[model samples]
Target: MFRVIVRSSISLAAFAAGFPLSAAEAANAAATSEEDSIVVTATRAPLALDEVPSTITVLDKAAIDRSQDIGATELLLRTPGITVSRNGGYGTTTSLRIRGAESDHTVVVIDGVKLNDPAASGGGYNFGHLLVGDMERIEVLRGPQSILWGSQAIGGVVNIVTTIPEKPLEGSFDIEAGSRNTVSARAAIGGRTGPLSWRIGGQSFTTDGISAISPAFGGVERDGYRNRGVTGRAELALASNFSVEVRGYYSKARVNLDSTRADTPDYAFNQEFLGYAGARLDLLDGRFRNRISYSYTATERENYGPLRARPVSLEARGENRRWEYQGNIGLMRGVSAVFGAENERSQFRSRSPDASLARPLPPFANGKAEVTSVYGQISVEPVDGLTINGGVRYDDHDRFGGQTLFAAGGVWRLPTGTILRTNYGEGFKAPTLYQMFSQYGNAALDPEEAHGWEAGIEQHLFGRALTVVATWFDRTTTNQIVYTPDATCNAASTNPLCFEPGSTTVRTAYYLNVARGKAQGIEAAAALTLGALTLDGNYSWIVTEDRSPGGANFDKDLPRRPRHAANASVSYALPFGLDIGAALRWSHKSFDDAPNSIVLDAYTLVDLRAESKLSENVRLFARAENVFDEQYMTAYRYGTLGRAIYAGFRGRF
Candidate 1:
C-alpha cells in the first residue's frame, strides 16, 4: 500500500505538471516580481522566479532598511497573505500565520538551517526573539511545501538569507532610539580574502514596554525587556570545485511578565543557539553538484516568580540534530533534477513547579523522536516560455510510521508581459513531544495532514511600470490537534491525564486529535513605480473554518484569523537625496476564542517615515508609528503599542 501510494503520487504529479497551462497557469511565474528574480526556498535550489511555479514574496535589502522595523515579524506583517498576533509588546509571545494557517504550520529557515523548539507550544519557533539585526533578504513561500521542506511546512516557509560581503573588507553599523526608553545597537564587519570568507556580527536591544494585559482590562503595570545576540559564518575554498562552510547563531533575552489581569513579579529568560558545518563538491565538470551538512539547534527557557515557594516556575530545554546530503544534476539545457536525504533527531525535557508545593521539585518529563526523509524534484522546459516541475518526498517517523508527499506546478511567461502559474502540494506533521508528555498530555494522538493548491496571474503593463498579481489558494487539513477542556477530570478520577505517576493534582485540559481545518483565501497585490515615486498595496480575504464533526463552532471562523486584511504604502524620493514614505494597515474583526463568545474589533494603523543621505556611507532616518494612537487588540485584552516616535542612523563602509 505504501509503495502504491508513493508511486501514484509521483505519477499524478508528473501528469499534473504536463497538463496545459490554462486555468492552472494561475500561479507565480518568473521570480514573483521584476525587482526580485531569484527564489531559493521553492525547491531548496536557486531558480529564477520566472522558472519556478510557486507563489513567493521577496524583500530585498532596500525594503528592509526603509521599514525600520525592530522586529522581524513586524517587517513580515505588510506582506501579502500574512497576519500576526502578540500577547503584549516586544519580547512577548508572538505568532505569525500564513494564509490563515496555524502559527506552527509554517517553517522558518535561516542561513540554510531550520529553527524550532520541541518544548514550545505547537513545536514552533517564537518570532518574538527574531529581531531585524543583520538580515539581508527574506522570502515568503505560500501553501503546503512538505515535498521539499519535509515537515512543519503545512502552511508555508520563511527563508532568511543574511549578508555575504562583496568586498575584501566591509563594515556596517546602526544605532536607533525610540519611545518608551527603547534603544537598539548593532554592528557587523566581514572580509573576503583569497579563498576564505568570514563574517561576525552582534546586536543589543532594550525597552521599557507597555503592560502585557490591556489597560482597559485592569492591567496597570509596566514590563521591560532586554535582548542580546551574535552571529558568525565562515566559508573556505579548498579547491575550485570543493568548499567547506560553518555558521553559528546565538541569542538571549529576558522579559517581565504579569499575572492574569493583575501585576506580578514574574519574568522569563530565554536562550537559543544554532550551529552548522557543511561541505560542498562538484563532479562531472560542474554538471553535478553535491553538498553534505550537519546542523544542531538548542533552545532553553525558564520562568520565575519571586514570591513563590520556588523561584523557578517552569524550565524547558529542546535540542535538534540533523544530517543531510543533497545532489543536483543538470541533465541538459533547461533540464535539471534535485535529490536529497536527511536524518533528524529531536528531544525535549520540561518541568513546572507549583507555587503551592513546598516539597522538592519533580524530575523533568522527557521525550524524544526521530525522522528520516528522502526527496527528489525535477524541472523541465519542454517549450519556449513554459516551465514545468514535479517532486516527491517520503518520511519515516519513529512514532507515526511513514508518510509521502507530492508537489507539482507550472509557469508560463509570455512576451506580452503576462505570466500564469499554478501549484499543488501535500503536507504532514507529527505530534510534538510537549503535547504527549507534558503535565496534561495525552499520548494517543495522531499526526496532522494537509493538502493545498494555488493558482495566480501576474501582469506587467505600460513598459513594466505597473505590476499586478492575484492568487487564490485553498487547503484542507485533517486529524488536527487541539487543546480540549475537561473540567470533570480530577485527581481522584481514573484518567491518567489528571494525575502523574504519584501526584494528586487535577488537570484542566488535554491535547487531542479531533479537529479538522479548512482555509481559503484570495490575495491581490499591485506595484506602480513612476520615476522617483513608488506605490505598493495588497489585500487578502481569508476564511478559515473549523470543520470537526459534532464539534462546537464547527462552522465558525478560526479564532484570531480575520476575514479581511489590507496594506498600502507609498514612497517618494526628493531631489535633495531624501526619501519620504507613509503606510496604512487595516484588519477586520475576528473571534477571540474558540467558543466565539468574544470579538476583537477591527482597527487601522498609519505610519510616516523619512530618510536622507548624509553622505555616500551614512543615512539619517526617523519614523512615527501608530500616528493616531489607534487602540486595537490582536489578542483579546492584550496590550498593543500606541503612537510612538523613533530615530536612527545607518553607516556602511
Candidate 2:
C-alpha cells in the first residue's frame, strides 16, 4: 500500500513539473510571494509581513485549493513544529499542537472573532474540525500573542479571513472525485452594487477511508463524512470611509473509526457542528475606525455501540458566545493607537444516558464562566526604516479574578532589504469550568500564566528573487493544572471505578496547581524565484520540558509533538498555459499520551498538483495527496487517510 502511494505521488509531481504554472495560474490559485503579502492585527492593526516582529506563515487562495484533497489536519501536517491528531479519519474532532504546546494553548480566529471555547478545560479553540470553504487567506503567528489576543494565544494564533467582493457580481463552482469513492462539491458567490454587498458558500464531502490496518481487527473504518456552510460581506459608500458588514459560517461532519485491535474498542461514528454571526462597522473616515462584533459557537459528540464495548459512551456538549468593540485612531503619519473592550460568556454540559446499565464513572457538572477586558496598543516610527509597537490589557475573569498583561516590540529595516525585529510579552488563561466545578473539580484552582519573548530577522537577496527569515522564541508557564491519581483508590476492586476518596465522598482526581514548564524553538522559512520556477520551504525545531517543583521528569520531552519538522514545495509555469506544483513533508517521531509513554514513529509524505487552461474561462486541475502512502497513526489509536487522487473543474461566468 505504501509503495503504491509513493509511486503515484512521484508520478504526479513529475507531471505537474513538466507543465507550466503561470502568473495567471498563481493568481487564480491565490498563491503569493513572501515579499508581496500583508498581514493585519499582528500589531493590533494592519501591517506588512516584514514589520510584524514575529514568525508568521500565510496561505493564499491558491495554496488552499492545492491541498483541498486533504482534511484540515493533514493540510497543516507539513507546517514546521506543528502536529495534528485526530480520532481516526476525516472530520473527526481534530487537535493541533504547536512547538510542543498543549492542544488548548493555541487560539483560532475567524474574521476577527475569537473562536476559543471558554468551556474548554483549557481556554483554547479545537482546530480538529473547521469549515474550510470561502476562506480568502490563512495567517499563522508563532509564539505568545497574549498581549493582543489574550489567553490561549500562548502557543500562537491562527487567523482565517474570507474574501469580500468589491464588484457587482462574481461566483465559482467546483466538483471533485477521488479514491475511496470520495466526492466533493463547493460553490461561492459575492458581489457589490452601490452600498450593498454579500457573499455565501458551502461544501459537502464523504469517503470510504484507505486501509492501513485490517477491518476485522477494527482498524481504519472505511466510510467517513464531512459538511460545511459559510457567509460573508462588507457594505460601504453609505458614507465615505464608512460601512456596516456581517460575516458568519456553520459546519457539521461525521467520521468512522477502526481500532487497531478487535478488543481495543470502536467508536464507528462521531459528529460536530459550529455556527457564527457578527458585524463590523468602519466609522469617522480614515482618521478613526470603530468596529463591533459578536459570535456564538457550539460542539457536541456521540459515540456508537454497546455500553461495555464503548468504555467512554456518552454525549458531551459545550458552547461559547462573545461580544467585542474596538477603536483605532491614526494619531500621525507614522503612528497609530488602538483600544478595545470585550465581554464573553461560556458553558459546558455532559450527560450519560447508559451510566446505569454500564459501569459508572465520575461525571462533570454543568458550569458557567464569564470575562470582561480592556486593551490598548500604539505604533511609532521614530526614525526612517524603524518601527516600534507596545500594548497592554487588564482582565476581570469571574472565576480567577483580575489579571494584567503587557507587550513591546520593534522592527528595523536596512537599506539592503534585510530587517530585524523582537518582542517581549506576558499572558494568562483562566481555569476552565471542568477544573473549577465538575464532579472531581477543585474549587481552589488558579489561572495559568506565562511570559514570552522572541527575536528574528528577514533578508531578501539577489534583487528580491530570494527571501529568508529566521526566528527564535521561548515561553514559560506557571500554575499549570494537572490531574494526578486519586491515591485513596485501592487495587482490590474488580471494577476500578469503585475506588473511595480519602477525606471526601465527592471523589477526587487531585487537581494540582504546582506545575511549571517552558518551551523554546527556532524556525526558518524561505522563498526563491528563478525564471519561470518558484521554490518555498520551512523548517522548525522545538523542545518543551516540565520544571514544576517535585516534577516527575523535568528533563523529558513533551507529548504528541515532533521535535523537528520540514516542508518544501516547487511550482513552475509552462509556455503552453500549463502549471505544475509538488510538495514534500517530513516530521520526527513523537509521543501521544501526557506521560510521554506511548510512541509513534517518524514518517514523510509527498503531494502533487497539475492544472491547465481548457479555455479562456475554463480550467482543469487534479491533485494526489499522501503520495507516499506512508501508513501512520493520526491519533494515538487511529488510522490516517491513505493515498488519494482528486480531479476537478472550476471556472467563473
Best by lDDT: 1
**Per-residue lDDT of candidate 2, residues 173-235 (tens digit):** 678888878887778887767666667777777676543344324553353555555555444
lDDT per residue, candidate 1, 308-381, as tens digits? 87789999999999999988888999998989999999999999987777576778988899999999999999
Model 1: how far is 284 from its true place, Å? 1.9
Taking all chains together, each candidate's TM-score versus the true structure is: 0.94, 0.87
What is candidate 1's CA lDDT for residue 263? 69
lDDT of 2 at 648: 86
What CA RMSD would candidate 1 show? Answer: 7.2
Specify the poorest-scoring 10-residue window by lDDT in model 2.
Answer: 1-10
